[model samples]
Target: MTNLRIRAVEAGDLIPVDLPAPRPDVDGARWRRTRVAVADGQIVGIASVALSAATDSYFCEVEVVPGHRRRGIGTQLYAAVHRLTDPRFPVLARAMDSFPLRRRFAEALGCSVVTRCPAPWIDPPTPAAESWATGQQAPAGYRTTVIGDRPLAIVKDAWASSFAWVHRAFGAVHIDRIPQMWDQYSKGVDPAASAVAVDRNQTIVAFSLVSPDAWDGRTFIVAETAHPDQAHGTQVLGATVATSVTVLARRGTRRVQLEGHTTDRHTPDVMRSLPAVGSDPMDILRLEPPPAVSRGGCR
Candidate 1:
């Protein structure tokens, strides 16, 4: 940690150190602060936190370059986070199951696992598209359209409303964060594969969001949902996914990846039936508050 300075900076400052571009699942407004551990004019570590209005806590992430790790750089960055952020609110962190060292590091930092969610990558058999082909038909009074063809405001609103039906162990998603989330991740979404179901009234009732894999060029179904208010919501959900698959298959995309969350009740059973080829589930950790000291005088 010698000659390292942990100073506050904008989120973009960490981009050089593998800070991912803003993600659609994460709301930019929730970002509270970011700090970089700079040494010799280069960033050696980074720590950032975003506020979850629903939980009233900060979700933090810290990283130290491979060469700089084990030198207390991460610890110092976190200490800087503690010094800058509100102490009344708790801090949370995430650890991927595939990285045992990450979990151990979180545990060593006095964090406890609060939730575990599977990040399964579903690679449906080529025949799955054929078997589910019939699902492409929209329910009566509903028609399917590509998400890119519709207004973003309309799509974002529909996604937020429909997602309310989902139950997650962590907590409900903040509707206010949907727009920014959509803005960040929508750029990568495949306009041709992502579809939405619209009612006769032109209201969006269901949607399937898809994107290409950055590494393999295959398709990845980012998200799919149907508004619970629709009488045929379930069917619409099926149709959207079916349509995406049919289109993908026609394009010679025999394999598709869909991430499933074990703690999410909304994941369809059909999706769960697919083989999980991704890393182990992710561990959401929370830093437990210290025990309260006695307020009364000692006897």
Candidate 2:
């Protein structure tokens, strides 16, 4: 019983659960948090229901005391998290394939496997300047411009239609995610970190959105978008990374990842550019609402 402490929370429990701080990126009204403390006032577990644009639903996370195993704290914490689900949008989680128990526990919570996602990675000190210079050999008529080099409003409108194209190309199972609009893609985004390739007529042909993976700004994720073809893919990928590399180097960041669903289209020319590819297959789990709840769930 090594100083373990846990109890049901109530209005006057006097237990100081360290709730997660509010994040502006998450939808404020839908965001939720819970914490259960242990002996010495340390966190034994925490359950959070946050926004996941990819799932078009709330994503869940349950943290437990490190190095404490063979205990039921995780089960208890997830039970509490299950109670917070809205049942309208799909409540989902990305269970790591490396951890079999994570998938088992999620199943216990009524989640079922949906699909796997690939999390590709790239090392620091990207390709030299000359190989991927600004506008390096863009499609004959195409040139390069960054997010901030052009007006924000025009850029948004130009790329608005491209979002649908990207979604179609990927055909993600969570079709609701795919950034249907520029506004959804721009939140918590650094304008300077993203890249856009445009034609002489002032039209966006291909683009890439790269932003710090977290507040630390040391690592970035690049979401590439372009027409479905080899030549266009190579051109867009090179130019986009080139533009974003400059932005990242300025911030002293040397690592970047290109994350996408397993079903998304892949171009060898683009993939070969960054040899270090780490595919973390995320097993998405989803649960349908109960019959009664499903009947009344719709607004």
Candidate 3:
């Protein structure tokens, strides 16, 4: 590497190279900030982090041009990012099955696999409003509607509270449970893209939320939760998918996506209810800086 330099950059700098947008999960301000490793004015790799005061950990993405590997660019880029994000926040990223080098690098940096499996994805073809339907009967006193039709705070509260009870035995990160982070997420996509089921008392009992897929403008399910009382919550989920697809399609949305963890109890029901085009086999890796590097955050 000649004259290799790692420096902070704006969102625009990353656009040309096609890095995925920072996770919509954040608090206070957006954290799509990028630090790039460049050699002789050519970008070699980019390292970025998701920041939110409300969450216990962070999510990060790093990309080093395949040809630029074995030269230490990624290590420097990662170190640069930790300086900006509090090193105390644990960071996670997906390691694709085809990219063993990325897995090795992430592992070398103290990351370990956390997801039960590569997340599952579903992209149902957008159907006409008249064609979309979920036949299950709504639980007594429960009614489903577009999330925006309800009060924002009620929806937000339900969104925040669901994190604790949904999958009791299986531990996982719930980024949207934090209101401020949810603030960042909700701002990025239409609230109509979300659906919620409310009980007779008007308390939200089940819900599903979607946002624009960061890599593309298509819809992606950012969060979902269902009350345990109703058919393992599938009816609500089914209604949610049906509502989202019909509404979004009316607005010209051609497709919708949802991701599931392998161990999640709802995975099977979700798969059976909707059609899936394919899945990206992925491993979620958790990362923390080394003691020496952690002392100063992201130096």
Candidate 4:
């Protein structure tokens, strides 16, 4: 075993670190520094947080080298990230189904199991020409359009209103924690890949954001979805999925996969609507300092 050390990531180290494939538009949004764990001068674990401008909330991701499992390294890494967080910021973490220990670790913190589902994968389903054509039919008051940087402000506002329920369901601390969500999206790798549905007045009613997966050459991930209100929820979701399918088809991609918590209820609806996709499992976890302590070090 090597001596373990944890520190903030540096510029030179940025390119080499195996970061989770970012959604296409993350660059426009700002990201906080990531913390990495090194052992014997080699990096072994990593963790970082992202804030969504539309929601003003933060979510975290953490990973550890396979060989170093069962130690408290994951826990320590989580605590370190939590230390830098604002107490009012609602934080979320996903533990893949393969990682049960990580789930337990998250429970030891204050997070509850919000949702779970099979990790779903979508490949070019034999494009049902009829269904594809049907999807192109714009809903009665809504028209589909590609989102551009100029309209990001309106989209962000609508997104916040539409996804507000998600924060309540997930125990998010507060909105406004992340101010760069839409801005980052505006600068994403392929803005053309994103689409939004708007009403007659040109008010954005729904939107979907997608990005290419660096690890899997042909796959693109759906990063975010927002709608004008709950009444239009299903329409927004359907439009988002359809838009992704259409884009992937045009790009000649054969498959797509969306990461979903194994416990979330919406997974079923997602599967039912897009039956061609198959669900697999992923794990999600979150860690926070014990309530009695104000910070990782202590009150």
lDDT of each: 0.63, 0.55, 0.60, 0.56
TM-score ranking of the models: 3, 1, 4, 2
lDDT of 2 by residue, 1-299 (tens): 46656543434434223444322323443355554535555556655666554434666776665555447676556556556666666666778665677676666556566656544455444555323444345667777667875554555543444444544442333434443435655665667777777767766656666667742233555445444542465675567666776677566565466545444354335545555535444676664333322232111
Highest lDDT: give the candidate number. Answer: 1
- TM-scores for all predictions: 0.70, 0.65, 0.71, 0.65
Give every collision pair in model 2.
Answer: none
Residue range 1-299, candidate 4, lDDT tens digits: 45988887654553234545322213333446478877777677887876643444567777777777567677667777777666775666766555665566566555654455455666644465227424544557777766645544556666555445444555552356333444554454355666677778887666655566633443544433343233444555566556766766676665566643323234345445663545445533334554622333200
- Clashing residue pairs in candidate 3 are 26-181, 82-298, 83-298, 83-299
Angstrom error at residue 70, model 2: 3.5
Candidate with the greatest TM-score versus the true structure: 3
Worst 10 residues of 4 by lDDT: 290-299
Candidate 1: regions farther than 4 A off: 1-4, 9-32, 39-42, 52-57, 88-90, 128-145, 163-177, 198-203, 214-220, 224-236, 252-255, 260-264, 275-280, 288-299
Instruction: Give the residue spans of candidate 3 off by over 4 A.
Output: 9-34, 41-43, 65-67, 83-88, 96-110, 116-132, 148-154, 164-177, 226-232, 249-252, 260-264, 288-299
